[model samples]
Target: MAQEQAGRVLRSVKWRADLTAGVLATWPADPRKRTSQEWEQVRTAIPGGEGLPSSVIKGRTRQAVTFLNANGRLPVDVFELEGAPRVPRMLLLAACDRQQATIERGDTDPGRVMLRLQLPTRVDPHAYGDWTWVACPISLPPMVPVSAVLHLPTLRVTGRQVRADVAYTHTVPKAKRTGHTVAVGVDWGLNTLLSAGALRLQADGRITALGAGGQFRAAGVLAKQHRLRRLSERLHAKADHYQRLTAGDQQHDLAGKHAVLSDEIQHVSARRANLNDALAWAAARWAVDQAIAAAATVIYVEDLGSMEAKGMGRSLNTRLSQQVRGKIVDRMRHLAAEVGVAVVTVPCTRPERGRVHFPVRRCEPTTSDRPHL
Candidate 1:
């Protein structure tokens, strides 16, 4: 009970921090086979002692480094310098790591984790971009730790190789749950489906089905794809047969069949594309609409592993659509933000795929219907 209570309090506090701390690595990416002896001098020269934070120096050795601080914010475009730009950057690790270092008082962490002052997001372009081994920013969000990940790893923020100065600021979470606000759950359909219902906890908790796409459009799209697939296959088969017939008799027949197959492929591809665009648009819009209707700040979604619906091995289209769900979340987040709403993903615990467990109470009505997608 104590541990569970602590976990809840810790999450509440940690989520409120302003930024993240993670790895800022710089490898000699464009090496033209630079030699061993040269590499030694390069490596040693990388960690300059002059006016550098000791924590930054220490980060140079760890697999995942932090930005404690750098000597100067150098320009990023000067990477072509003969003996500059290799300065191993120092990063401020936002939380506890394997290092077991001394903890700082205010740094975000599980235990007493020690680190440097915060790093800034913007670097002066004129001041940045020099030094043989200067540590630079990797143009990516710092790594964040999530506790409930399984199956595929929780989607992590990655490093972008293009930027030079490193700065990570975690947006503080507002812990004050809006008493009047309600939440809504979103379920995405496979091959164009939609299910949405708002879960209102304000006043009294209520589950209201807010949106549904009638089966008519969904059935039509599915049937069209099936018919197109068959048409393309038959045309292809007819072409093969014609090509095996007498050469003099085959020319016109083969040409017509191939043309027909090409057209069918194009037609099917267009239909699928339209269906996907519509489904995504609907999902995002309804989620946002429900949030607006309930006057809520937070929206909850399935912590879908790899953003995929539960099923057999995924095909290319399925994979492509799975990726599209991420974009939907992104857009929904943006729209929600426009209206002062926050979007969150709660994990679908294995034994309980659709139910949300509360610390003080649980609601069975939250999972009144099975997943439709």
Candidate 2:
């Protein structure tokens, strides 16, 4: 009787695996034809597909449909297996209505939370009788509920790692401006990465200079550029040497040496990128910190969208563009949002009567007689 029961369990597992593989194989090429009507049509065409659960079939069909709609086509390969092809890792769909998967804190150990995956008996009757519950330990932030779970094998790593992506909604408190109203004007330039001027807005519509000429230095940018240039030259020399050797001698193998030089070139290129990213972030942080220290609620930055680097040499243009002023602005905007400070971009117009007036309320020009700044 026990041997017969084990054989039945094995057969059930194999059936589920075959069913999943079949569903993936018959995935619709047209994303529009992935509705319930289409799924039923395709399922009826496949032999033994009628025996599969409607819920499972719908879930698999929905997954494939979503992928097709987003990427404009199906994935190149569906089943990414590791060792044995017959026993594949299942991408089980969670039924929210049935509560097949749930997250809750431990009863005895309050700190220890767990994710419970309840397998339905319809998939496997004998082994997973009625409803088989498997509890896996998990850690999550306080009061955050799990929305969905994606089951997939770990890539390029050892041991099983279940990554749960959780999302929650929180209200942001209104900012209370208790201090005096201050505004900071920022000018982005090639020589000085950022030049900031702090001003205090008075009640009588008068602006006083609290501080002026604040700058953030793009340190080590030139040095890194020089290093990258040298690395490129070395890479070219090595490539030339390899080509000459390969052309002259057919016996000697220079593949290993060529690969080493290529790898070194790539490493230097990556290092240069890393350095540039670090500098951009650092400059942004400095600008934000200066604004915070000055108690400025509003920061006005020069908009460089329409500004052209005309009459400049190729080398100068490359250096100016590569400085990534836009990246600095983007980072500054993100960092400023964390606090109550607002970053606004003003048009790069020339100062009228030796003073640049930024309309804080409307952000529109008062008169159209100003030159480009």
- Residues 75-139 of candidate 1: C-alpha lDDT, one tens digit per residue: 22212111232322223232334232222222353222223222234553343232122222121
Query: Model 2, 1-373: lDDT tens per residue?
Result: 2344455557865765565566667666563346776677656755576654454565556666677677876544334211233532332322233355665556675545666776565855665467778777855454332322223211121127545443222232223334436877887777677888788878886878885558876556855765686677789798779967777464569866776787887777777777777877888888878888898877778776545443599767656646667778877775665565777777655766755666554332111111110
In model 1, the runs with Cα more than 4 Å from the true position are 1-181, 189-192, 200-253, 305-331, 350-373
Per-candidate clashes, comma-separated? 35, 1
Residue 1 lDDT in model 1?
Answer: 26
**How does residue 188 of candidate 2 score in lDDT?**
75
The total of clashing pairs for model 1 equals 35
lDDT of each: 0.42, 0.61
